[model samples]
Target: MDLAIETNNLKKYFGDIHAVDGIDLQIPRGSLFGVLGPHGAGKTTTLRMLSTILHPTSGEAAVLGFDIKKDAREIKKRIGVCPQELVLYPRLSARENIHLIAQMHGMAKKDYKERTDELLGKMNLLDRASSLVKGYSGGMKRRINVLMAVIHEPELLFFDEPTAGLDPQSRRVVWDFIRDFQEKESTIILTTHSMEEADDLSDELIIIDHGKIISQGTPDELKGKLGEGDILEFKIKEMEQRDEIIELAKTLDFVRWGKPVGKHRIVLNALDGLRRVSEIMDVVKVKMEDISVRKNTLEDVFIDLTGRRLRD
Candidate 1:
């Protein structure tokens, strides 16, 4: 199978801080691959190295078969990167900004004009295409940023939080746009804070923490790693009582595992969790703010592996 990206012991460091420490990856062609990590987990740093914006401290990597070090200019020509921070001209109209990227790629005027209108329509920004981007809302600008990245029609794309500020309706539009883009057999490397986005779009995903990959699999496979069970979430009124409840939860044989999530919520994985809710509640003996039981999700597997929620 042709590979879109390949890496071996990739590393990046800043003084004593090893930002991306010795990692390997293999992403197949045309896959929507996800890179998930909490803040400072080296997701962006790794992307930079792979995109040729940052030189790696060590290791070898290839993007679209071009050596990241030797063929950086060639790699840059074939890839589009939408960074976490918006990169756009405040004075440029949305159409002009996208056209500029197309121009950089040496696209014909007619080709860029037609593609610009099509992309703008898909992002729900065609009506605003003539307007200066500075006047646009955060979400609208975000959508434009995405458009600029893809205007060149690169074979490989890297999106670092493409829908950070979008509303539900607008977010769905971007999701649909990405889905449509992937259908063209383009490879996308995405890093997102939204688990729903990752679960919905990623063909495979890796969860990174402290510059190391802790877990990787399909979203369902990662969730399945937590075993068969339901999740019982108990919201405690008093944050100080979490430890006591965790200890109490350990005594219950029905509970497969238990951990605290967020500020005052304790989550437990248990077999037949719905039926054991009352018994589990009886054992807690705490001031309960609320409680609910639901099936395991990718976030649950993330929490179980990293020992904290994605935001934390």
Candidate 2:
């Protein structure tokens, strides 16, 4: 396969914390890939290694056909990275910032002028092209941050939470640009905690936890890993009562697992979920103001593998 990125036993340690403990990855050319994980799950550290911003403590890796250790300079040139935090010059206009990067990349005189105008227009920032970045809205600044990363027209791109804090409309616009990039034949690797964004944008998906990959496949493939069952979610106002009820649920053959989600919520995964939902209510003998049951979701899979409780 034509791989855009591949890694083996990639590890990054910060003192006692094994931030990105031994993990392997392979992302193919022309595909949009997603890295999904909760906070402190090593997703960012892994991205840093792949982008050549941080060196791995051990293991081998490659990006865009360049070895991470030996060909880092080459890899850096071919890959564009949009980091989670904004790194823009507040005093510089969007165009000037992009033009400066283009010049640094040694873009030809005609090409530099043409690409700057083209990207600004495509990102819908032409109207604000001359305004200082300090005047831009959160969403607008995020868009420009992404735009600047790609000004050199790299073939492989990395976007770490590209739409993390954007409004729905802004997120949708960012998605549009991502779709356009796919249409134009660029490979993208994105890391986001938003299930909606991953489901909508990824051609393939990977989930990491505690510094290792727990799962990898197409979204549908992993969702298929779910046994034909239903999951019921309940938000409880009380904790011990919820646990007591779930303990009773453990005795039922139809119920696969009864797990408390938080201090006051429990989720039950059961066979023929809807049919047994009423029985669950009777079995638990609890009145929940809000109860919902549905087919498996990406979140359910995450919980199934990592446990239902919150991670610190």
Candidate 3:
């Protein structure tokens, strides 16, 4: 298989802190790979090293078949990065900002001009293309940030929290843009705290925490790791009764495991959840505002592995 990225026990340290520790990865060309974790999980550091912006303390990596250490310049030429923090000139118009990046990449004027207009249209910013970035809303700036990174049409793209502050409509637009880009066989490495986004976009993903990959797999495969079971979630009418309901649920023979999901809610892993709803309700003995039965989700898999939500 042709690999776009290959890392062997990659490590990076900042004095006393080990930001990235011995992470091994093999990402194939034309694949959409996701890196997920909570804050301080080293996702950004790994991307920086692979992008040739930072040197690794130890181990080796190859980006687009070029050695990251010795061929840093070659790697940069083929990759685009949309960093976690927005990078846009507030005083520049959206068109100017994107055009400037394309020019720096040495693209032909005709090609970049056409590409810039197309990107602006795709991001729903063509109407505001001439407006200075300082007057744009947060979501608009984020869309422009993404547009600038992709204007050069690099073979590999790194998106760190690309939709961090986007509204639902804007997020959908960006998601469609990324999908269209990948349809052209571009390799994309994405790092995000949004479980739904990762589950939807990734062909395969790695969950990193404490500077190490804790789990890696397709969304379905990771959820399958929890084994066969339906999830029963009950929204309690009274917040004070949640704990008591959970304790009662644990004692039920039909329930495999029971735990609190969020405030006023308790979830149970059990077989035949739909048929056993009455039994579960009888056990909990609490007034529930709502009850839902569903299959395993990526968020569930993450919580199972990390003992916390992705945001935590």
Best candidate, TM-score: 1
Q: What is the lDDT of residue 29 in candidate 2?
A: 94
Candidate 2 local lDDT, residue 308: 51
Q: Candidate 2: lDDT of 189?
A: 92
Model 2 clash tally?
Answer: 0
> Which candidate leads in lDDT?
1
Candidate 3's C-alpha runs over 4 A off are 233-254, 258-266, 284-293
Per-model CA lDDT versus the true structure: 0.89, 0.85, 0.88
Model 1 lDDT, full chain set: 0.89
Query: What is the lDDT for 47 in model 2?
Result: 93
Clashing pairs in 3: none
Task: List the candidates ranked by lDDT, beginning with the highest.
Answer: 1, 3, 2
- Shift of residue 122 alpha carbon in model 2, Å: 2.7
Model 2 over residues 35-84: C-alpha lDDT tens digits? 98888889899999999989999999989888988888888778788989
Error of 3 at 216 (Å): 1.0
Candidate 2 stretches greater than 4 Å from native: 241-244, 250-256, 270-276, 309-312
**Model 3 lDDT tens row, 1-312:** 999999999999999899999999999999999998888899999999999999999999999999998998888889999988889999999999999999988999999999999999988899999999999999999999999889999999999999998899989988998999999899999998788888889999998987899999998888888767888877877777776777788787767777676566667787788899898778777776688899887777776775566675
Off by over 4 Å in 1: 237-244, 250-253
Clashes of each: 0, 0, 0
| Candidate 3 Cα RMSD after full superposition onto the native fold (Å) | 2.9
In order of appearance, the predictions have TM-scores of 0.94, 0.92, 0.89
Error of 1 at 121 (Å): 1.2
